[model samples]
Target: MTFHVELDEPRCVASGQCAVVAPDVFDQRDDDGVAVILDESPADDLLDDVREAVAICPAAALRLVEG
Candidate 1:
């Protein structure tokens, strides 16, 4: 299984929740502070943190599509 992680930059509030929850998968851009996808398809072990990041995103800017 693979997960597709996407970030809606316009909706991001730069809260950095995703980064905190899953640093290996999510990060903030140096200039805008918007959330960026470091790893679109992370390993299974990181799935939990990725899901938590998606859930805890304050602006609902993060999404997870599993396939």
Candidate 2:
């Protein structure tokens, strides 16, 4: 299965939790500290971290869609 990450900036609170959970897949913008997707479709090895980041997002801004 392949997974894709999505972010809703308007709902984001710039918490940086996603970045902390998966540094390689996510980062915060220097200007707003909002989460930025570094890798929308990450490798299988990174799926766990991506799911964790999505689950822990306080604003529910992150989602993992499997295809």
- Per-residue lDDT tens digits for candidate 1, residues 1-67, read 7888888889999999999999999989889888889999899899999999999999999999998
TM-score of each: 0.93, 0.97
TM-score of candidate 1 relative to the true fold: 0.93
* Model 2 clash number: 0
RMSD of 1: 0.9
lDDT of candidate model 1 versus the reference: 0.92
* Each model's lDDT: 0.92, 0.95
Q: Give the local distance difference test score of model 2.
A: 0.95
